[model samples]
Target: MLTRISSVDHLEVKQVVFSSVLQLGDSCILNGFSRALAVQRETEIFYGDEGNFPSYRIFKKPLPLPPITESISFLRHNINPIIKVNNIDVTAVSNSSILHVGNSQTVSMEVRVKHIRQLLLEGHEQDI
Candidate 1:
């Protein structure tokens, strides 16, 4: 297989976070995994209590999904092998994401996120 890229004028990538990949060209296999936990509280609370949170415990455990068993095939017939690209502008790629250009054989990605928001008022604040 022959791949010809003419030009890439401008490419702006802001952020690539949490087990992400930005690949250009041919690839045989790509695998990515990410896990995140975000907690927001109205008032400052005890940092040590984070371990008691249920969501925290879940993140500690391994992913509880079955294994992947699949097969894939690709056949490419190019009449004009000249690939032209003027410009590419990207904002963000996050959380086990992949931004790939050209040929790829296999790609796998997984992401898990847990968000908790707490807005509780104490006894004095509740009266007001």
Candidate 2:
């Protein structure tokens, strides 16, 4: 979205709001050569880039939901924070770091399979 700010000089400025989101973990490294999409800007909250990277990292540790039950207990229990590490010197960093939560989708699918397996394993001699 292009937000035009009109100042006294009628200057037009731009602010972007990304509709899509990407997630990354701490000490994750990726080169722009692999990602064809032109990564405009990268931001982080924690003290990312702890490895002295040469590539820009998008997000620090993103929280993934549990395998079966979607609960916020882990997040609440942990003191790790969502830091804002924006306006980075992209050319200077090769890797990014962050506090990561568990993978949500994978966990959910695993839980579902386990549940169905349990149901099927139960003895069934009903005549209905």
Candidate 3:
């Protein structure tokens, strides 16, 4: 398998709020050009809790501005992500552009994989 540190990136938010949280989904899109990186045609996406920077704060009102501490981190590890273009395993990020913090050591994914059986969907119940 090809090893690459550049498969993913990060984004910082004032707090772990709704709109920001939704940005983590599979088809989530961010509308901005990469400042100085190889330009890819499709919308770019960042992933994992390694990229979460939550600024926490308690307000007298329902919502607060300029949070104090980081909270509610979301991270995911994927060996064989279904994304058609690239498969990635996001580790972590902070105040940097595409920071790489994992090992470059090569390992076989085939030897360790366990098959997951899919359950069939039927209109009527069948006798076992």
Candidate 4:
């Protein structure tokens, strides 16, 4: 496989987090795993959300079957030996994600999110 780019004018990436990858060229393999625990409360009170919490701790355990363990075989035929791009004006890539401009053999990505939202009304003081 071949990749060619004449011009890349601008590329803006605001944020990338939690085992993320941003590739501009060819790659054999790309693997990413992200786990997050989010808590949102209406009031200013904090619930002490931390890694020690049971929900957050669950991600620490190993996966049942990881992608790397599996055997993979593939054959690629490159009829066109060259890939030409005249111009790339603007690009934005964000978050546990991949942006590849060229050929890729294998790409694997996994994301797990647990979000908890709590609302406290003005007249619900007794509920607490």
Which of the numbered candidates is closest to the native, going by highest TM-score? 1
Per-residue error at 35 for model 3, in Å? Answer: 25
Tens-digit lDDT track for model 2 on 20-117? 11233232232121111222222322344443333424322233754766555532332443433433222221112112222222211111001111
Ranking by lDDT: 1, 4, 3, 2
Give per-residue CA lDDT, model 3, range 9-102, as digits (tens).
4433333321222123232223211111222322223333221223112111242246558667877676764323243343332221222233
Q: Worst 10-residue stretch by lDDT in candidate 1?
A: 1-10
Which stretch of 10 consecutive residues in model 3 shows the poorest summed lDDT?
107-116
Cα lDDT listed for each candidate: 0.71, 0.26, 0.29, 0.63
Which residue pairs clash within candidate 4?
none
In candidate 1 the C-alpha lDDT for residue 50 amounts to 63
Candidate 4 versus truth, CA RMSD in Å, comes to 5.1
- Tens digit of per-residue lDDT, candidate 4, span 8-127: 345566555556666676777888766676777766676564544455646666657645676889987867565555554434444467766667887777777777787887898776
Segments of candidate 1 deviating more than 4 angstroms:
1-9, 47-76, 121-128
User: Could you tell me every candidate's TM-score relative to the true structure?
Assistant: 0.66, 0.13, 0.13, 0.59
Residue pairs clashing, model 3: 48-75, 49-74, 49-75, 54-70, 56-69
Output the TM-score of candidate 4. Answer: 0.59
